[model samples]
Target: MVWTVMPDFEGYDEACSQFIWDLPASYNPAVDFLRKHENSDRVALEQAYPDGRREQYTFRELDELSDRLAVGLADLGVEAGDRVAVVVPQKPQNPITHLANWKLGAVSVPLTVLFGTDALRYRLDDAGVAVAVIDPTVRDDIDAVRDDCPALEHVIEIETNAPAGDVHAFEDVLTAPEHTDIEPYESTPDTDTAILYTSGSTGPPKGVRHSHALWLGRAAAAYNFFDQGLGPEATVWTPADWAWGAALGGTLFATWHHGGTIVGYPASGFEADEAFDLLAEFDVTRSFMPATALRLLMEVEDPTAAYDLAIETFAVGGESLTPEIVDWIAETFDSVTINEFYGQTELNLVVANNSNWFDTRPGSMGKPLPGYDLAILDPDAADRGVAERLPTGELGEIALRPHDRSVFFDEYWHMPEKTAAKEVEGWFVTGDLARQDDDGYVWFKSRKDDVIITSGYRVGPMEVESAILEHPDVVQAGVIGVPDDTRGEIIKAYVEAAEDAPAHETLREAIQSVVREHLAEYEYPREIEFADALPQTTSGKIRRKALQEWDAQGSVDEESP
Candidate 1:
């Protein structure tokens, strides 16, 4: 599919020069995705499962399905402003649940299928979910915590065999009368649409609430980062879970807002060969991938050599992209450059390396997207109630002005104190460290908790990890600071060697030598440990916290003398 009206941008300067921040008083994402493409029978979602089953749905079909589900849910006593938890795998039903909730002016709380019983119970109880739409596969997990969730009243099962006692079958819900006379709820821009929980790396996952306007605000991202205009014919895909904001907001909502198609596939785990196959099979035009997934994909022998890929734009996030991975992609794919974006579940897509607007910088996180005011402020200023912007090239905490209501989140659900702690004066502290160059490009450093201070020098693990990745034998790398009596904190590198590489003293010296050449001698790792695998989060981020704990427990092998 080709766009009816192509996107126009002179360059990065012109694209960021102006933006439209006005949102309609009353807006619904479901209405926008369907009404804009109502006249055309374009495919909205195409699902491919590992079991060799494929499903395709048009915009009209999804509209009807969500409409029926909304009416059916309303029949089950769900009302406006109520909390409804949606836990499903990557399928058409996932987005359907979101649209259904929006249609009723109800809040949709997305939960990843990876969550265990305890994690599920915490979020369900915290959000006070009134009704839950869950995939049948995890029914038992929910059932284990059902008695604990006092606010949970009903359970609706989707993609399952039959309805058990008290469990409402999704098939039955969809069987609602075709012409059920249920009027769509009229929700203002301020009406709540979703409560997305963070990955809970530091502590318990916080429920980040977003209004309908916040969902609609992603349009600027669709334009600047995606290089898409109205009625774009782009087919978007991402390996990230639908529950995460990157997939929900970045891929699904962004693509639909531009009237583009979304491609989805079911895989037990990520396989580079299968991913390449899906790209070629569906002829995906645009895609988003986490850096971890990209690293794994690059490990495959000649990833792009075998497939006839139609992907034109590839955007990566969730972690930093090293120069090694960027160069690998450049050499493998024809006319394809890696576009990196920076955002969190709380704030969708704030900063990006937009290839359409500017050249793709390997390590730079790019400038802020239109409609956002971003800066590097002194971290100590958080207690003073006024953010002090650091000079160019000075590393500091990244902060955003909270006045951008169209793009910023409303609050953390049921946690007023925590929400209040996130703001200082009028700035919302992102808690991530970064520095901006004079050219207006922002370079991501590390999370505030992940930054290391050793021997009177500050170091971001990303730079060290990037340097280590340049070695031929390294498949993946994780860097952390260990307790040191002399240096306060010393750099320790955990290297995951390639399948054929051996763990030896000579290899460790070679890895350290690369860092010494690329960075200062103080930044190089003093100790290197070859490991079979590194700890990672379900969302594909390296779990530095876990690595830190392992170091505390002395789980890492001692460095060779």
Candidate 2:
């Protein structure tokens, strides 16, 4: 299980100083992660259920199952370059479907099970998915949208008592006796492997297309950030939805690319206790969780004391990491640093706090990764092809060099206009607001759409949210701009209090004072509201757009300013 390409570095500086983006012309991730280990009996995946049930699949077994499924799919008219939609939970079947699609040189489209009929149908119609591997639990949702998806010809059901007349049983595809010795499909490294839809915070979800070479490039994040190497007995687990790029690329693809084992669980309704139990039982060495989940885990009484944790490297993404939670993790876990990574669904892992290479600075998203050239550019001037790079300490949109194919996405599926909008000359605008320091550390501010403008002053929600999180009574915080006739737009803060914390005027004033201390007076939240919990996406990112919508409708119950 040796890697074909080895990073030439002993430390962070050496790695970044001499980085190379060498990849083979013809590459298939299935052949690298699964076929290369087909003769070995080492467990590739361990599926743990909330009810304490566990299932282990060796590399050999998974390889054969994927081969059989690939053959069965071919028999059903699925060919190279076809889109195969996978709508399921985080389980063996999800990755199994991914492997099977790659084996056929087909593209895999991962759809979250949380998506309703409209969202599911929109993606299916958008991608022109030819076949779908779906869980029976979402059969009704799929059925409601199937008529609208003209390209969808086959439906494969997983874990069902009875499938519809036109539907194929998933178990039958894996166990089909006629296709046990099928050869894997051959594809070039640049062949598209997967299309992951975004969370649609600003608009409808866009299909992000990544090639096989791009998928293999995820190994850099593993080797540099997670300290994973060939033949390491590392077990990785993440509670993020498989549909999101964070879990799909960070945990599943990265772990397997390094020949490490992956741990999967039912990710629909994730419970902190169950997650901790699985991590302890499996002795997971590398773990990735969203910032929201980490905050929730901290709410549990002495989680590290209750569960025997073997986690050596813990990474978080999808949102800003507060200094308070970072301190809590440092104190709770022995010799573990809460590594932070910054990237979007379009570009995965551009900047990261690799504890193996450099020390982490709390509240910073660290430096740009090797093989990527990142900069903060003026968002207003980007479209005119005059995107000026901002100096250090000035907030602007994050953009990456487009020529770096190893780290950048190919396009937004079938939307060339949208893809063209993201690029300025040779730079791919990330649409995320951030600023860099003289030390080369990138400080994430907020999404360009999430920035607040109040009284001729620009405010980033992350800075204010980070300050609000420092309060002893606050657990989660979300900030947005509400319409104000006087100031044009006023800063509004939504705070989720800690357990047993009183939500009163005194506490609100204290929270406001924290923001006032950290930022300018105009940037401080003028309106404060208390909520039991903030709305979050499936990937655990706070839905600030939802809050903005609520404010637009005047549905928010605001405390006196």
Query: lDDT of all the models against the reference?
Result: 0.80, 0.81
RMSD score of candidate 1 (Å) = 3.3
Q: Can you write out model 1's per-residue Cα lDDT over 1-561, one digit (the tens) per residue?
A: 112233466766665565445666667788877666645478988899898899998888888888889988888889998999989878888899888888888999988888789989999999999999998777999999999999999999987768777788887776465555556788777788888888877667889988876665555565556655334567888888888787887778778777888888756678888888898899888888777678778867876667888888778888787787788878888887678888877776788887777777778898887767787889878646677889999989998763357567889988898888787777788889989998888988888888889999999998898888888788778899998999999999888888877556988999889999999999999988777778766676767777777777777533310
lDDT of 1 at 134: 92
Best by lDDT: 2
User: What is the TM-score (0 to 1) of candidate 1?
Assistant: 0.94
Q: List, residue by residue over 233-310, the lDDT tens digit for candidate 2.
A: 889898888887878877787777777899889756757787788889999988888877787787778887799998
Task: Candidate 2: list runs displaced more than 4 Å.
Answer: 1-5, 175-178, 228-231, 556-561
